[model samples]
Target: MASTEAIAAAFRIDPQILEKWLEGKQPVLAKYASAHQQIFAQFEYIGGEWHPKLDRQSSVAMLDEPSQSQNAVESDRVQHPNSSEVDLEPQSTAMFQAVGIVTGAVHLDWETHKHSAIINGSTYPLFYISQKRKAFEALKAEVAATGNSRQRLIVYPRVIHFPNKQRAHEIAFQLVGFDKGQQTKQEVSRELLDFEFKLAGLWQFIPVCRIPCISIFRNFSSERLDYIKQAEPAKKVKFLKASHLPLLWKDAPCKPFRFNPKAEGDQGHPTFVTLKVKFLPERNVFSFVEQLTPVQETAPPFLKASKKDKASLRRQ
Candidate 1:
């Protein structure tokens, strides 16, 4: 059989919707199609001051690969810039508190833009990936250079979900902060989707400061991701083979399954990775302080005396 992507591309259908159809779960594919359309539109071209793109691996070819096992990698314990990119405005004071690596197999999820930043004699603002899917086929097999050998060893694959209408609405309200009915909503929705997709492209490849316990689940399919979301009310899960949803709180992180690029035939399916998750501090957004001062009574003495007399009279 043709790969799911190939088949979907041939028919001009979203690959995610096609995955469910292949699985014989065909009732509500329309909802997913709606979301996929809105989200995919913004990914075409993210013109920005700084963008993340793939740079060649910095490591000079060694006769033998580094003898770094999983344990050694952990013991070395490098903190990645540990990214979950947010286009922060002049918000409050915040610093990406716990800076380190996001463990498990990482995927460069979005396109990267380059700006001139140099650190330790190396270029700053390097390449990475993030939020949503890019063009149909190009995103899946793209290479991410994380100078870290640990991240390099893992598989990379296409793992993303379209922004649901609710997500779009939230982005519209929070980022755009205006609601002129449907038109503005749609515009903001596109903006949010584009922002995320652009972030995914950059962050996925760019290194971070914190080492998070996030593992990419191999061999998972979009259909399976939907099914996993259908847990009972107690679990508050409702995704699984239904549709793709964002990974909300890293604190209460959801282990959505994803395919590993290098994993063989069955590796494209999804499964949960058991990570020892530890909450990290907020990303630093500059610093802050506050000041207060006493105010003298500006009221006339007659008024003050009248108020006092009124209080005394009431007491009597």
Candidate 2:
């Protein structure tokens, strides 16, 4: 079957129009004629609404609730809070925090066209898949121990990939809060700015520094490696000769994953390495003394100061 983009381009119409027709847009039949009707009907029968283009409001509503029961009977059914595209794994009540992965694919020029042509051709198409799996794995263990299935844990993963490097940097900074959080009255602001510039695209920057850690899952299957090798004309991709890759932690020491590279390559699909690296917020212990942090009081303002006292002060 021709890809959605290819089919849409052939019809000289927006892919969204084709999508609308597939979503029971009977009015489109009169506009496009019978041939297009057959095409749309086939799409509905095979693809169904599995690939339905949801509007912003519907998308937001779908994500608002976390503990919605999913109908497991239907294979192509939509689940609230956790769709096939984005999965919200169950986490512990104590560790019940929202985690988001801002993933971007840095593609080679020729491979870019190949991916655009094929629906699932991109290497990082399942970019958020592994991250979601890790979050679920961590949370499931905790939930199993405590027997707290009622607790809601939300994990949102967003994939962003564009050619512009500067825009990518902006996205990285925005996700990490390096741009916004660096605005405090301190001498270390310049150092933070420099760090943001260096680790823009290569590093996946997480917003919440304390709760969740950014983990990198790398698959070295022969097919994937071949795809990478063929995709890159310059041949910049390199394999680690060591069995285990080094793990670097923020504000902590480095610990490496143990594996013999030579032994792993004996198998059909060579090696697979996943590194879970934690990025903690760099805190200057001395700076806490320098800056007088604002105290957040939950009590009403008038409770601390009476209304009559305020009235007397206003009269004066």
lDDT string for model 2 (1-316, tens) is 2346656665576778777766666456466776475454433222221121122222222222112243111111111111121122233121111122222222212222221111122232121121122333444455466664322222222222222322221011111111123345433343333211111011112221211122222222333333333322211111111011112334322121222334534322111112222212232000111111221111111101122333343365
TM-score of each: 0.18, 0.19
lDDT by residue for model 1 over 1-316, one digit each (tens)? 1245644564467777755654567654565665445433322211111111212221111101123331111111111121111122233222111111122222332333221112223321222222212221232343223242122111111111212322111000001121212344343233321112111100111011121222221122333333223423211111111111122233322232332445555432122222112211132111111111121111111100122222343365
- Clash number for each model: 68, 1
- Location of the lowest summed lDDT over 10 successive residues in candidate 1: 167-176
RMSD of 1: 25.1
- Model 2 segments beyond 4 Å from truth? 1-213, 216-247, 252-316
Displacement of the residue 107 alpha carbon in candidate 1, Å: 19
* Per-candidate local distance difference test: 0.23, 0.25
